[model samples]
Target chain A: MRRLPLYLMLSIAALMVLFPLLVMLSTSLKPLDEINHGSLFALPQDPTLAAWTKAWGGACISGTCRGLSVWFANSFAIVLPALFCSLALGALTGYALSLRTARWVDMLFAALLIGLFIPPQVTLYPMIVLVREMGLFGTLGGLVFAHTVWGLAFVTLLFRNFFLSVPRDLLKAARIDGAGFLATFWHVMLPLSLPVCAVALVLQFTYIWNDFILGLTFAGPGQQPVTVALNVLAGSQFGQQEYNVNMAATMIAALPTILVYLLSGRLFVRGIAAGAVKG
Target chain B: MQRVHLQGIAKSFGATKVLEQIDLTIEPGEFLVLLGPSGCGKSTLLNIVAGLEQPTGGRIHFGDRDVTDLEPDQRDIAMVFQSYALYPTMSVRRNMGFALKMQGLSTAEIAAKVADVAKLLQIEHLLDRKPAQLSGGQQQRVAIGRALVREPQVFLLDEPLSNLDAKLRADMRVELKRLHERGRRTTLYVTHDQVEAMTFASRIVVMDKGRVQQCDRPEVVYAKPANRFVAGFVGAPTMNFLEGELALLSDGPALRLKENLLPLPGLWASRGLQVGQKVVLGLRPEHIGLAAADDVGTCPGHVVMTEPTGPDLYVRIRLAGQEVTSRMSPGQAPSPGQKVALELDGKAASLFDVADGQRLN
Candidate 1:
């Protein structure tokens, strides 16, 4: 067919994008001696689950021999509560702001927009002092609080713009139907915002899951997330690096975000498009 | 049913006055429609009555209970929107029952009320379907059913049928009229469509530039519009306006157009018509008809165009240096360039003072 060349180019582009993952998979499956002696692109003649198992549970990470499992649990602990708290607060704030036409609401929204543009590093010192003042510094709660605070600006912006597109008459109708503010939001606005929530969820999940500096600074050693643990495992100074274990560990740390995207990719695209077009 | 009274309802946004000094009352079980062109502030007035928007100056009362500062939920009102505004995520049953449920009604009571409304609106089979699954007309009925389930003291609708197709709109109009007849609820409807206002309103409030021009029975508003604006706005193919001055003809007082003197009917003679008084002639298309061979008070003209709508023909005539339309039966429709005489009924025609646009004899 006439489209053969276009298909060929697309296949080549896909291969180029997937090549690094393929190499990581090949390197992770090979034995240590084979990896040292053979080509990087070579398939493993005798594959093993040694590196995966070691990276998951047995390898030393920052003088802790219990590998990424504890830290994986720590990441989930930080992410789940942070995600729930931030999304709940963000959606409510967005809905409330969308209903009012006062000048103060717009000024407050502008302030939130200003909050969104500042890099996390710029606020890390102040946040530390604040958290320390609250006696939450270096605790798992501190990390969750940090992530939730940083996530609110973006999540609120997303939901606020989405909520603004809803028909004003719908709100009036709800009011005339004898539904109060919270009742209308709970029954009407929340259900209508499912797509926007998905977009926020996936994005917040990725940001919180992959975070490094925040986890390193705010979390206690025992509560450090997998990103910090992965860094420690990969950069250990005493011994020769185990490339296979590091690669496998990197793969494990990145798995949840990948799966989150894969499961809800269509909805994510739709949500983004809906927000963009409507806003 | 409760009487609705809106006293001195005035609203202004910054420097722009949207409504000014609007005072009206609706008797129990009256269907009063606020009709106007776009930006006439009809919708704003309706919002103020429903307690959705606060007026800068007003007090609203429902049967002697002042509700001006009350939130919409406390006003015991229900409204149907132009877009229907149905809860898209809920089934029709839940959408209808939501308001009752909000009042802390038991499930049995809510379901009973919802079922009764659904049956009344003939949307029982659509109870389980989401709003998105239904067609436009069905969603509209569901929206109405949602309002009906509340059985509130006041029903407010803002152009509820404007979004439907012509046929569906006509059907829904009849259905809404029937529903009102059964419930006898005090209702306020806002729309820009003259036909909808004429057909559905027991009384039509004609508004322009944020002011009420005339509020009267539909038939009275149609036959004798209070001012030039009402006369021109309330009719289809819009009323034709020609500037002239009152002059004396051989038989009677007449309106003098460029070289043409239109003889006035005998009824205007006793109204103390003065000679050489300037006025604008407001003539409805239907009032200008094909003249009989020996008809008196006829203005001669030539047809410029003929528009054949299904049942009637609207002929645009070039008369006395002005273009005017004459509605005629299809069988007697004139071709372009055909010479004709149009009978202008001086008795039915509206004469407006050129200065204030107010009606004159």
Candidate 2:
């Protein structure tokens, strides 16, 4: 009886967190006419898969009728390579900073941390020029490059801090076992870094997949990710805003990040627990 | 397999020196133990020998080859750390074979060598287990097995048993001595436990405050400690010291206390002895005992406390305004506050110069 208020408070907090997702899901299932007639809290009166199907393949974006599928593939193309590059670079950089005895790493990491607080807008013009100089200004490669640089600081910080807590004696033992620089990282450090790797993957995937500004700036006309495509599909230029289709599109775009969290949620929690106390 | 030599090894972290001018050699198959309290630089010296830490100034030679600049693997040595330091993600088989694999050994040869070491260590049942799955003692055996599989020139152990409980540590200490006997590998071990140093070391190096106070056999170190620090550091229940001045007695050179005179060793020379020279009288606990009434050269003391540890009793006696402990057999246990006369074995007693704390002949 005494725990009633505590449980009530927790349930209310969870509802608050789940309320927006619930609205998006209900609206996505409802047709446009029913959505307009029914209140936001009401259950979908006549649910149909048509809006989801149209949002996936038949929705008009700007002038084109091609739906979010192409942009979904583009998202993967940009995110996969960018995720690979950033995560790989981040893990190695973090390992070197935490385990190796390079005198310059601490300063280098400090300078990189300044990048995290800088709004992406502040460096957009310089990055655009740099990408153009490399002749990849509006290419997918350019977008991947930008995302790699954008995520490097955060993932590197995560990995470096996590690896810092690993026992130094393990590294020494590896060295005495004849494993050198890269070998020690691969055999000893990397194998022991599975939990942190899940954290890095989920983090980088969500950031790169959901990014719109960088995609709009650098992904060119046809190469834009689903986020930018979702904007074009639901923007003012598309005449009337198809509210149901728009909600369905947003739901489709959010599915991957949600799926990633579900798959690695256990690991994410464990990693946070393991990584927090060490810091 | 190789005799190791260290010449004038010194180490400093920035401006603070941790070790200085250390010169020692480990004969092939010799078990040399560096024994000291924490912060005594014994572990640092072991690291220097293992090539894990470079010296500020020194030359290390393995057999006839100079290995001062070589990496640990290049120097062909193995180390067991205090934490055991088993690779957590690998199984026992993989861990023991890691160094051999690094040497590019064939699968068959690595397997054979691992099997041999596994059987020797009696850890064959644990071959499939990860380090975390085994008990502390099993992990330690696997750690030793990993060192053995490599067949390195020298084995370096840095307080490897300090992390274990008392009982397990004693068991592993016997196991380590047995392994050394079977393998005959030149090993340098570092520990703060006097019993470990005394039982396992062919030669023990007693260090204090980054300096080697004495390097000799365990019996020699215990019987004749080079300085006051060693005398105090190397024994359990510790040696007792009574401040006094060296003076010429009518019979011979003697140590003059506040109210009594204790005779020095009969073979003692008056060469370094002087009248009224300040000195410290050192007596091992076992060399003092309860005296009979009217026994000459016996000083009267009153018992303050007695501690019994099955085989013997340590009786603390108040004498000359100071507390002195004497180890007596259970049969001779005296009750607290009882008056007794204690006899000092003059022939085996040591005297130290008060100013320098160096033992005086």
lDDT, each prediction: 0.90, 0.88
- Model 2 chain B poorest 10 in a row by lDDT: B263-272
Off by over 4 Å in 2: A100-103, A276-279, B248-253, B263-271, B292-295
Can you write out model 1's per-residue Cα lDDT over B86-117, one digit (the tens) per residue?
A: 98889999999988888899999999999888
B131-196: candidate 2 lDDT, tens digit per residue:
999998899899989998898889999888888899999999999999899888999999999999
lDDT of 2 by residue, A202-251 (tens): 98999999999999999888888999988877775635667788889999
- Residue pairs with colliding backbones in model 1 are none
Which candidate ranks first by lDDT, i.e. highest? 1
Clash count list over all predictions: 0, 0
True contacts kept of each: 0.81, 0.81
Task: Report the CAPRI category for model 2.
Answer: high
Give the 10-residue window scoring lowest on summed lDDT in candidate 2 chain A: A270-279
TM-score of each: 0.97, 0.97
**Model 2 pairs whose backbones collide:** none
